[model samples]
Target: MRTRQSVCARKARYASAAVALDAAKVAGLALRPYRCDRCWQFHLTSRTKGKWMPITSLYS
Candidate 1:
């Protein structure tokens, strides 16, 4: 599990939940992409960070 300081709790939880739900929809013996919980969390963190930084920089 890669820890990124910029990640927040809410987004991480949401990402995890979404990923789990999606995985359930197609959880039948397959390991191609391997887009599991961790991947989803990392993606969400980076995406959120990407969206947040630019807007925040404007005010500072």
Candidate 2:
């Protein structure tokens, strides 16, 4: 009976691990490439908007 219980526990652990791996895979795919004002690939999404607003008054 003790061995059966241990086997069941191990199976549960493996199931939880599989679930964690699947979650990570889905999360990885949802990641987007952030486009910064400088157009650098190093920056992620920023909280402040209008980071790319161009300087104007050249329409004269």
Candidate 3:
């Protein structure tokens, strides 16, 4: 059972959440690493509200 969401399918996929988070960190943007249900991979999103945000110096 493999069905990739259109929004996620066309986007980059990270093998792990750490990798995704690191990529975001390098980008120097406050991005949230979330596990995609459709792709079963990690993806970054800018939507921070109601989402877990890392209490790091970059975010702070």
Most TM-score-accurate candidate? 3
**Weakest 10 consecutive residues, lDDT, candidate 1?**
29-38
Task: Quote each prediction's TM-score.
Answer: 0.21, 0.23, 0.76
Count of steric clashes across candidates, in order: 0, 0, 0
TM-score of 1: 0.21
Question: Which candidate has the top score in lDDT?
Answer: 3
Per-residue lDDT of model 2, residues 1-60, tens digit only: 122444333332212434544544555632212322232222222133544433551232
Question: Candidate 2: misplaced stretches above 4 Å?
Answer: 1-15, 29-60
Alpha carbon deviation, residue 53, candidate 2 (Å): 43
Candidate 1 C-alpha lDDT tens digits along 1-60: 554445433432424545644553465532112233443442222123223344554464
Which pairs clash in model 1? Answer: none
Q: How does each model score on lDDT?
A: 0.38, 0.33, 0.80
Residue by residue across 1-60, what tens digits does model 3's lDDT show? 234578887878999999998999999987878888887888888876776555684448
